[model samples]
Target: MAQHAVPSAAAPDARPATPVRVPVREILPWAIFAFVLAGVLLYFVGAEQGATSVFGGTWIHEFTHDGRHLLGFPCH
Candidate 1:
């Protein structure tokens, strides 16, 4: 009597997975929007006081007071 080899039941599939692609053109507008949004937020938190005030009062500064101190901005 001769012994024969047996195949394993846990063999991997032969199909390959497709890779995902991100195009720069599609992301540029969103990147620019985010940049502008960040700039606006930074302005409100850092420079929304004194002569550069946008709302003509301390409302923005008061609202972002804690954040200013946290980010090390001169609030006083």
Candidate 2:
């Protein structure tokens, strides 16, 4: 009896096989921008959430709880 030949299962490479380069200089500006934006957004969220320091109490927190008086809008 004759034996049949087996086929290989490896695939051919179509890429350069080198890793892509990242530019730190270009990335630095966007990183800083994102950090600053996140900080500002966090501040607003904290303020809305009634965050206070030792120096003083949260005015917005108090105002939100004290009840809002409005001429055209309903108090919530």
Candidate 3:
């Protein structure tokens, strides 16, 4: 019987291992930034410009006023 020794060599540099990407850890700051941006856009867009509301019809008017009240904004 003949015995053969195994060769131990590093992998070829031609094909490198894929790099691992990690997500951002500080997401709260980004979320706050987005919230502020949306508010600024909404302010410039003007809420009263639209006749149609998400609530629809008479319920829409009531819902809008109630939402404003809940948010501490005086609509009426």
Candidate 4:
């Protein structure tokens, strides 16, 4: 009969786990970029129609038509 070896509770080579450090300085630029992008998207989806449109056409409104209704902007 062959005997199986069991692992010991106190392993010698195991190192302590450390929490991941997030570099805010590195992330700040991208965060600001994303914020600006979100603002532009919100403008297109909610208010890109009638008089306050950047592009002078109904195409932008039609493109984001369903999105307006979905986000409860009342663009009818």
Candidate 5:
């Protein structure tokens, strides 16, 4: 008995996938916005009180109190 070769299921004429182009210019603004937003959030969580406070009174500090302690920031 002769052994027969198995044929591949994939088509030979299948086109190769093209690499997708990332629009840097379009994404840059949003990336920058996200970075700034993250920085602001970090500031609020880490240093939104004492001398580094941006807003007057204890409103911002109290609002983010739990977040501050959760993030390991010293609060007294």
Candidate 6:
């Protein structure tokens, strides 16, 4: 009678994952820029209209009409 060897149940490549460090100084400017950009977009999509209009005419309203309705801003 011949005996066969059984395989071991050891795990392979069990290394821990290291977290990357993000510095605030490097990301502050970009964050601020993005914030400002978002504010401007919000204004255009939500407010840019008559009485509170920055530029004259219905062009801005027409341009952002769908966006206004999409954002739940009443244009009509």
Top candidate, metric TM-score: 4
Range of the 10 consecutive residues with the lowest summed lDDT in candidate 4: 1-10
CA deviation > 4 Å runs, candidate 6:
1-15
Q: What is the per-residue lDDT of model 4 for residues 1-76, given as tens digits with 9 covering 90 to 100?
A: 6643753457675567799999999999999999999999999999998878889879999999999998899897
Clashing pairs counted in every model: 0, 0, 0, 0, 0, 0
Off by over 4 Å in 2: 1-16, 48-76
Most accurate candidate by lDDT: 4
RMSD of each: 6.1, 11.5, 11.0, 3.1, 4.7, 5.8
Q: Write the per-residue lDDT of candidate 6 for residues 36-57, one digit (tens) a residue.
A: 9999999988989978899888
lDDT of each: 0.87, 0.53, 0.55, 0.88, 0.86, 0.86
- lDDT by residue for model 5 (1-76), tens: 6743753447575567799998999899999999999998999888888998878999888999999888889889
TM-score result, candidate 4: 0.82
For residue 41, what is the lDDT in candidate 6? 95
Tens digits of lDDT, candidate 3, 1-76: 6643643355354455598775676777898899999885454333532452333345444545655556665545
Ranking by TM-score: 4, 1, 6, 5, 2, 3
1-76: candidate 1 lDDT, tens digit per residue: 6643643455464355699899999999999999999999999999999988878777888999999999999989
- The number of residue pairs in model 3 that clash at the backbone is 0
The Cα error of candidate 3 at residue 69, in Å, is 26
Quantify how close model 3 is to the true structure by its C-alpha RMSD in Å.
11.0
